[model samples]
Target: MKYQYEFFLPQNPKPIDTITGDIYDCEKKADEIVAELGINEDDDLIIAVTEVGNND
Candidate 1:
């Protein structure tokens, strides 16, 4: 499944960055991506489910 992963900082109303892809590409990759950029435990990761391509 595909998803939109958003990385947000504490007290922020919007995400700093967004990544769209499958679990491995979006979720896992986002983890590694943010770990290097610097963040604290107060930060949040919001996952939004999305469908890519056509079902029919």
Candidate 2:
């Protein structure tokens, strides 16, 4: 058996526009990092989800 873990941005941060319910990217900036960079900006913010394998 093995366990998995992931590191993401925000780290439980607050939202930017409560009315719009905006979300921010944990890894990189929205304007800075674009689809060309292999990351898409969903809504007005960006987000990234990654996992690590348990090398035991």
Candidate No. with top TM-score: 1
Write the residue-wise lDDT of candidate 2 on 11-48 in tens digits.
Answer: 44543322111233333334454444453456435243
Cα lDDT listed for each candidate: 0.61, 0.35
lDDT of 1 at 51: 65
Candidate 2 residue pairs in backbone clash? 9-26, 25-46
In model 2, the Cα lDDT at residue 8 comes to 26
lDDT of 2: 0.35
Deviating ranges (above 4 Å) for candidate 2: 1-28, 35-38, 43-56
Worst 10 contiguous positions by lDDT, candidate 2: 15-24
The 10-residue segment of model 1 with minimum total lDDT is: 39-48
lDDT of 1 by residue, 8-40 (tens): 665777777777776677756566656876544
TM-scores for every candidate against the unseen true structure: 0.53, 0.19
RMSD of each: 3.4, 11.9
